[model samples]
Target chain A: MARKLYELAHSRAGDKGDVLMLSLIPYEEEMYEKLREQVTADRVKSHLNHIVKGDVIRYEMPNISALQFVCQGALLGGVTTSLGMDTHGKTLSYALLEMEVDL
Target chain B: MLRIGSGAGFSGDRIEPAIELAEKGKLDYLVLECLAERTIALAQKRKKADVMLGYDPLLEKRIRSLLPALLKNNVRLVTNMGAANPIGGAQKIIEIAEELGLKVKVAAVTGDDVLPYVFENADSLLFNPELFETASILSANAYMGVSEIVPALETGADVIITGRVADPSLFLAPMIHHFGWSVDDYDLMAKGTVIGHLLECAGQLTGGYFADPKKKDVNGLAYLGFPLAEVQSDGSALLTKVPGTGGTLTLRTVKEQLLYEVMDPSSYITPDVVADFTTVSLREDREDRILLTGGRGKERPAQLKVSVGYDAGFIGEGEITYAGENAYGRAELAGAIVKERISRNYDEFKVDYIGAISGHRGSFGHQVNPYEVRLRVAGKTFEEDKAQRIGEEVEALYTNGPAGGGGARKFVNEVIGIVSTMVPRTVINAAIKVMEVGQNGKETV
Candidate 1:
């Protein structure tokens, strides 16, 4: 169920060129394999066509659990674009938390 | 006489005396020690409660009054009050200074709070599985050395705020910055590092933790007045206390501070140097002052040590005791029975029986006599349910033993499980980005 949810969210996120970085607390190698099986680079690239251009996607597995995703270029012209307003970054962080990942 | 000032970790203590001595008595720098392990945890909780406004408000309130006075007197301030949030602490200081209308350039050295970043890139960051398993890290605070703070000093920062930096770094940074010492200059940096180690604990260098020879008048010593360091451009430093301060600066006090957290006296690694503590020498310089000199250091390591955390398994423990005529035998039998019961019920459980008993010396000056014994059984089960089951079995041991009717029944059961999966470890990795921005215009150190 978690894997399916992660795949759907990841695919949706990938359509917009935003890379998903997954970190598992007390990192387990099995999680990396599970993620690889759930989502592919091509599928993520296809999703990116719906969002923004020049977005870099990255997947990271830190020694800790809990995944992290960096959505570069997705917030272009957003509040963080000026660096004066931190709202855009906060919003994106909140949105990322809302993303569902399949176990 | 060389004048110096030091600050302690508790609250309600004022920095006024330290300030007066620094300004009026011509002291070189003032050192304040704040952050502790528990304090960091508290600050983290408070920060989480209000992310927009970081840290407890009291630190800012007290520091606001001291900033203007310290800046006016030209007494440099170094402290670890930055806790887990140095950047936020720096911003707060900047805000407070701006509010007071004081143009104090504040320099904050970060890269210490790498918990968020490490969590962001855990899988790609860690290579070892065992590193993740054994460590149940709650907080991974990067222990930054002092070299980074030098740039802030060069940038003309009157007040420098930093996160979980080594206690010695606060003192070493000012020496490095003021003397323009090179990183590879092991001898000079080692001398500064020694000065830092001496003054890091504030009152500890004075009579606070010292063993007085007379043992008289030691009880009247106050906690507020701490020791200070007067560092020269020549890379030498002197330790002294403020005038009218209650503490005494003896060779005993200085020696105690030197040996505080040091694991190895010969090779004490600091941000400045791998110092040789064995070569250090000290002498009393008049009343309330001690001269510290002669510390040799080696080159610093290339990488910074980062703390990382991961998950570990759950654990539970329970203890029960038995007492009666054959207390020793009964205790032993009771332990065996309990273990047997647990083994029968649960496949995965660890049990340990620890205690001492006095038995009869059959043929000696004493006739056959029994002694009392206390048996403590502790075990851990992976499953919480299984732990509870084991707890029930241990509790029932008291009523079902050979000495059941008269045996003592005091059992404690604690269930332990992985509530969350996060353990912290220190990893020494390659350098990231190095940019030196100081008053002299950004130059790479």
Candidate 2:
């Protein structure tokens, strides 16, 4: 059975201009490889297709057991210009966590 | 080892936690990093309105509240609360110190405002065309490095304030001053920079933003504690917070904050160093304490990034709530009415069913059956009147479309768009001015 990303890991979202940086940390250190394998830029880009309008890039932090997804053109022109209520895209991490994953 | 506490993480952070740190936490320095990317631009707007009003609005309140406890504990303060006016901010601090009958030396680090240089070298700057094009520029500030702040600390000033200096550099400067770390020592700079980054967001490191209810519960959130770091000469630090204060400091909180607002962790660029967050390692030293080590840095970037705030028209917003049966449908209907009513007049229009899909923009799909929902309609337009109309349409729903629509609210904000560009590092120069007040309340500069 497939599981939600939230059940296997935790995440946090931050913004820099129109770019959104979302950090994904697995609940257990052993799950790091699984998250890295299943959670790709394409998967995340498709998962947040509505909110993100540009490219998605991923960076790994093996020592910290985490993956950072840098989503471009994600904030509808970011905090200053975005018409959306969540201008900072702070809630998108939960939205990303809603993606289903094979654990 | 130098014990440094964080008084604030942002411009409008809580004041009581900082007071608590000063009153109890044994510390050498308390850094209150209060500037955000768009904040200086907003401050520029205020400075235009009044010459002396551009600094952080809470400067007086924070200074007044923390002065006694800070002085009593000998905890020197280093903050970027100056916003767009470090000199004015320092003067305000001196005034507050005089009012409290306390002797103090406050140093204001200037030269971050690079509007003139930006205009002179506008064509040469690396522009992000997507963010703005020929808009009226409001403010341009270069992120200064530790070189500017060390002199201020060298003056033996009780407080150091700056404007537009990099957030991590605010914490890194004291380490460079106290430990005598060379700027070229990239590894040490990286290590210190990581320490700065970790403690910069005071409460976040203490689980302020980490609460997930049953999944990731954090206790005492009402009075959440702020973070502090005990730095060793070798560049490793022990991160913790005041005991018995609200919030938990664990590996989970530390992990989350380590990458907060960070992009490309291997090359987290700052004016002082290019810190590699990938090299960092965290260990639980004991209860409420995490020992962090293994941060590395590379040579600093040749050019400094400048944040430019420009006038970007206006944002008009309106929201109305609907509850009871078929609340989502009512809210959706209300949104359709507003969009049909006036969306064609604006350059950009957005309709959001607040409870159903506003935040994710329908990416997560709609809630099956929401008990209540808010209909929000917003737009971007050049004219203020056009912006104001977005809210007017939604408010009309109280009588026209939705039966249960209530609590209508409207807002129109003059939009300021913040974009980034890179300028030669040499174009930026940092200068410091020291102000003092004696116990007798005589002021000197």
Candidate 3:
């Protein structure tokens, strides 16, 4: 399902100069803790290498819950095609909602 | 007493409509209210982000077009569209007047946006530490009284733009300033405030929101007519709308608007007067006008009230319907099963049972018989995910329940977080000052 969503978003943007940020939350709390032990920031960065181009890939772990992946500059034509707005302000909100990862 | 006019909710052509009516109808004062509560909140958010440019940059363009007509018609304008950027609003109006070669003095009334003041004094004022935690402080506006506006008018500003003056005070100020109506003249000022309230929403009283079904059918009703208050020196006023407009002005419509948006009907307080609505009487006049007579006003309150919001915990709820021999009993059983499942997963959870059909049995006026029941279960937890899980469990009840036929149908769930904050009440202690400038001087009124 995650790969399908990625493919759909990629097809919509024509996959040129687009960056994809994938945010995932493991089903169980212990599963995330185990994944944390196995995956370092560099390994996660390498895993996301296919999606990252010129922009940076950032990871954030909110204290309450959830791990968020932020991909920049990968969106084709930036925000105009992504969120239908020409501003960086409105596009940021659309990008956050688009990268949904369900565990 | 100063004679001031106050009204709200205006758009397009700025003061031309008011000035035209004032000139053609020979009105003594004109007040326009353009800021809604939500507009103030949005403006405050912009100000906090340091993007406060001016109150609607388009306002000056509209005002520029209307100045010549306003000056020729001798209509003094007061409005609360200034939002959090009154200074910016004033400067733009001044620039327009200069460009048009109209010597109009513009005075801006400030100190209404209280976000900075509240933040500075939060430590001493707020009782709870959590009150200052979250940033939901969209806007902080002061409900200024008539006393503040009279002085700015006295300063001889032909156009006065304010932040968040109370809706009625705009009308009352011109009356109190021109007529010398005493603060204790509650009966007279109350009449003025009532007049202001009726005319506040423009066409609202004049058939815009009238209860008459025919008003809904009236053609060209979309371009609502603005209100006009004809005040007498004795404190009696006539409320009417712009001429040749497609709307009704009736006592019933005026009374309905008087009761709308107000918390207490008896003590409807403005800056200059605390009006007792019970004393007001509305009479339909010859034209599309309502004569407001005998409103009892009283001393203004000491402290001005402010509204604030804070962060609260998250909540989620789901509902399902049960129809069977023992529908109510089965609904209760379904709630218990969901509670048990949620408790096994999380230790801290708040659960509530809401029954929608419990009152229907008594209100239907028929012999009570077996009927279907709708049960709603809502749970609140610190963790948002746990709240979502509770919603999932409630949805699963249709397949898993006692009798294998709880008949749980049409399940719906929603999750929402609460924001808790208090609006600290304060007093506008500044004394009223009225300064007069000559008509030929830089300031022209």
Candidate 4:
């Protein structure tokens, strides 16, 4: 079945330097492996191509059933220099959560 | 077991919750994490104008409001509220205690200020050394660890003030000092660091900012309880908040916070240790209580991360609102006209349709335009007058260009921010000073 990532998981956004770190956790603990297989760096990179300027790195946490994506060059110039109203990219997590995931 | 209560999460956090924690939480230590990356830089700018006024703006109110209860309940404090001036902040706290006729001891940790070292080694910054040469650096501070702060707490000081220490170290130091934990114990340090991270945001773990409607509804949000950690001698912790307080403590909330600002699950770097959260596990023992275990750590990083704040020109921002039919078109036209007016004066300017694609352009798809939208234009310039022109141009759109532009708002800000760099550990020389009242009820440092 195809469903929005938000319906399957919950995520939060944080920033450091010019990178936007988004943590994605499945709503049900049993779906951890499914996310590990589907939410690859390439998949996420393709998902947020317009939002991110550089490469994306994904770190997996099997025990916690969470995945963290560090999207580089995603904040324009980051908190200090970015002219965008969403300076810290606090809402970028929603863009990732809006992606369609197959379960 | 040690009960560590989180008081204030940031510089402007609510004060009343902290008092409640001190008076009723039955805590052994109270830790407040208030300093952010650019906070000290702004405080330094204020200190440049007047020497005695560079600490946290809410320092007096936070301390004065909580002093009576804190002293009465025998709760000790550890904080980085000394934004740009630890000595001045310490002196101010002591003076406050004296005015209330309460005996108290104060301690200040020093040597995080690396402004001189930065100027000397700007060209040799470990990463991106080139940025420092051209950056008009304002303040450079190194993140200190438990090394200096732990000793200061050993002096039995009622309160400790510090500059830029890692947020987690505020909660971890007292644990290290009280439990006599080995400084080289990586596993324990990692566990403590994780607890610190959870409590550092204070109310976030206790539901200050995590309430979502329908999906994750939280109860009694207005009186949300702050977080506290009941840490064991074996480096495990149970995270919870006060009883009958608003906000829910659940596995969902803890998981979200665990990864907050963390780069890698295997190597989360801090001055004290490289905390690895890869195999960490958590389970709810009961309602509003989560038990955390299995944190691992590696050797500490040799170079400490330094946050260098510098002047970054000025930001001029202006906004205007349009409503009813064709509002999006009118707002777009208003944005274009303002851009045309200010483009000549500014080298670069950005126009964002606040209510439209400014935030969610990607996922929102190509739907019909919003009935009403806000148009905002922001520009950066070296000259204040030129920065002023961006807003002035936007304000002119109401009478001169747009038909129904209302609620026009504008502002100009002197932008200053922190740039990250790493310096060798040998260069940092952190110190600590403890003060107490003598036999005559006079304070001594």
Candidate 5:
């Protein structure tokens, strides 16, 4: 079965400098492995290539059953220096949730 | 057993919610973390102009509305609203107490300014390296911890004001002051830091910022309640809100906030301790209570995070809208015209035809042309007049543009922003002073 990432997980975003961090936690503990296999830096980078200009780094948190994505050079130049409205890139976590996963 | 309430998370947070927390939350400590990365720098700018304006703008409003209740509840207040000038902020609060005819003690924490040290190490701290020789910094302050704050809390100060302390430290100081927790106890410090981190954002931890509609459903968010940490002596915290308030307390919301702004789960750096978010686990102890456990901490970092504020010049933006037949074409033409006119004034400018490919970062042209579109031109320049010129060039498109170009608007605003860097702990030498209300309903420093 195929489902949207939002269907399997919920996420939140925070920022440091121009870098944005997104945490994706699964709805169920069982879904963590599926997310681990399906979600990768490449997929996330490609999925958000529309806005993310820099590299995307993904860290696995098996203990918490979550994935943290650190997207660099994403805020046009970062919040203080950026002209973009989504300065903190709070909306990007939802954009990551929009990703689809095959279960 | 100590209960700390989060009155505010950031500078512009809603004030009424804090009033509710002060009146009904039954809190021992009400901590408001208002200063952000760049707020102090901006506050310094305000202070340079007027001695009275450097603190948080809502300092009086927050005090006027919540002070009486806060005093009635015996819930001492602590906040970094002191921003760039804690002394001025404390004086303002003392004046408020006088005007209200209420007696309360206030404390102002100082010595975080490191501008002199920044100048000494200017070559190393420049974000652009080129700024080492050329740019003069506007403000520089080190992120302080609980060293000065705990003593102030011990002085029985009803209100504690600080400048540039770590956000969680605002909450952690009360914990240490009341519980007699040793500052060197990394495990307890980490646990307390976890509590501070959770409640620092105020509403974000309690589902106000975690709602996703279908995926996550929050109730009555219009009046979302702030967070409260019921912390035990053993370093365990049960997070809840003033029951009967808006918002949800789910495992999901707790989990999101648990990792908010964390660089590494194993090592979340702060001035106080290198908190380990990985060790902590969340469990729903009840409908509205989430228990946080297993938090451990390591030694504190050697370098405290320093926020460097410098002038980023002025940002001038102009926008125009287009509709009807050939709207996309007309908008694109308008963008081209503005770009040609504005680029000559500055070396660079951004032109976004904000409907077809604006969101895509203009990487690929959209096959489906939008029925209506907006043309926006924006850029940063050292001169305010040059930034203003960017908008004027766009307005020129009204007469020089294709059919149906309308809604032309432009404005310019100066930008004050912080650059990321670090400094040694010796640079900040944080100090604390207590100010109180005299018997004549006047302030005594």
Candidate 6:
């Protein structure tokens, strides 16, 4: 079944310069493997293509059942120069959660 | 076990939660981690304008409100609220102590500023050449380590203030001081570094950023409690908050904070050690306590990271609202008019339908014919006069049709851009000075 990523996981976003770092952690321990196999860097890059202008790199943390994505060219110019209302891109996590994943 | 409580996460954090921690948390040390990346740079600009005014603006108010509780509980304080001026900040604390009829000792740590070194070596430094060539440099500060802070803690001072130090270093100093851990001990350094990173954001581990309606709910958010760590000699700690407070301290909250802002899971670099978070383990102790242990570490870096702040330009922003039937269409019209009018003078511009397209850039799709919407137009320009035109055109929409435009507002802000470079550790020096005040209002240096 096709389901929203938010139904199975929760995420948080942090920023440094023009790069955006987002962490994805599953709600259940058993779901970690499914998220790892299904949610790849290319999938996320294509999903948020409208928002992120550059490449996305994913790092795995099996001990904590979490994944971290470092997306470049994400913030328009960064906090000091970005014209967006949420200059820090704190809302980018919710936007990542809005993606649809095959479950 | 040594108990340490987080007073304030940033410069302008809530005051009452810190007071609650001081009054009831039974803490041995209270560390307030302020000073963001560009904060010291902004403070340096102010110091250039006037010598004694570069410290945190709320230092007096914060010290005045928490002094009684801190003194009564016999808890020592450590902070980077000194910003660009640690000596000035330390003097202000002494003055406040005398006024409140209390005796206190304050230690100030200096030598984080490396502007002179940066200027001498700017040609060899690794940074954006274009920015370095055109922009005027404002400030450059190297992140100091626990080596300087431990001496201040050793002075037996009631309060310790510094200009720019690593956020995690603030928490690790007390652990190193109390436990007498050697800096070369990488295992202990990693464990202490993880604990510091988890608690550095203050209320974050206690549910400040972990609330969602109908999905993951948190109770009593109005009186959210800040976090404290109970550390043992073996480099293990219990993360919890004061009882009867408004937040939760479960394994879930701890796990969320464990990876917050962390780029690499295995290697998180600080001035003291390169911490490995993958080895850490967490378990729920009781209702509101979580036991944390086992974060490994490697050797420290030979070079220090420096934050460089410079003038970018100005941001001119304007917003106006349109309501009552076909609001989206009318808002779009207003956005087009402003963009067309200002495109000649401004090269870079941003137009957003605030209620619908601002945050996600219309990725989530828009509402079906919303009753009201706000239109925002902004531009980047070097001249303040040119920036002012963006808002002027937005406000002119009142009489120029697009119908029902109201609540027009505009702003122009000077922007400061930040970049980073590396400097050899030996290029910087750390110094500490202590100031004391007596009960009779007599000041001694």
lDDT of 3 by residue, B1-445 (tens): 2233333355332344454455564555566677654456555556556754648545665576566766777778877767767766776677676666677767778766666665666665455546345423445456777777778777767877887777777767777778777767777778778777766766666666443243224444555555676778776767776677556665545554665444344677666678777666666677667776777778766666443323233445566767757766777788788877776654334333334323211222234334566665554444667757766777788678654334333322221111222333453333322222334433422
State the lDDT of candidate 6 residue by residue for B176-257, as single tens digits.
9999999999989999999999999998889888888777678888999999999999999999999998988877677778
Model 5, TM vs. native: 0.94
The lDDT of each candidate is 0.52, 0.89, 0.54, 0.86, 0.84, 0.87
Clash count (model 6, backbone only): 0
RMSD of 3: 22.9
* Model 1 misplaced regions, further than 4 Å: A1-103, B1-4, B9-25, B37-45, B53-58, B98-101, B116-138, B211-219, B309-445
- Order by lDDT, highest first: 2, 6, 4, 5, 3, 1
Residue pairs clashing, model 6: none
Query: lDDT by residue for model 4 over A1-91, one digit each (tens)?
Result: 8988878888889999789999999889898898888889999998888888898999988878899999899988778877888988988
lDDT of 5 at B49: 99
lDDT of 1 by residue, A1-103 (tens): 5433322222111111122222111123355555554444344333433322344343432221122233444432222111111212222222332233455
lDDT of 6 at B258: 83
lDDT of 1 by residue, B71-167 (tens): 7777777777777566667667766766676666666666566666556666655555344554443445566776556666666666677666666
**Position A89, candidate 3: lDDT:** 25
Task: List DockQ, one per candidate, in order.
Answer: 0.01, 0.86, 0.01, 0.72, 0.53, 0.71
Tens-place lDDT digits, model 5, residues A1-103 = 8788878898888898878888999989799998999999899998888777799888887767888888887877778867764668776777787788887
Could you tell me the lDDT of residue B245 within candidate 1?
A: 65
| Candidate 3: residue A63 Cα off by (Å) | 60
lDDT of 5 by residue, B205-314 (tens): 88788776775788889889998989999889899999889988878888888878876778888888998887888888998799888889999888888889888778
Q: Which ten residues in a row have the lowest lDDT in candidate 3 chain B?
A: B411-420
The 10-residue segment of model 2 chain B with minimum total lDDT is: B125-134
lDDT of 3 at B398: 68
lDDT of 1 at B188: 79
RMSD of 2: 1.5
Q: How high is the lDDT of residue B211 in model 4?
A: 69
Models 1 onward score TM values of 0.55, 0.97, 0.56, 0.97, 0.94, 0.97
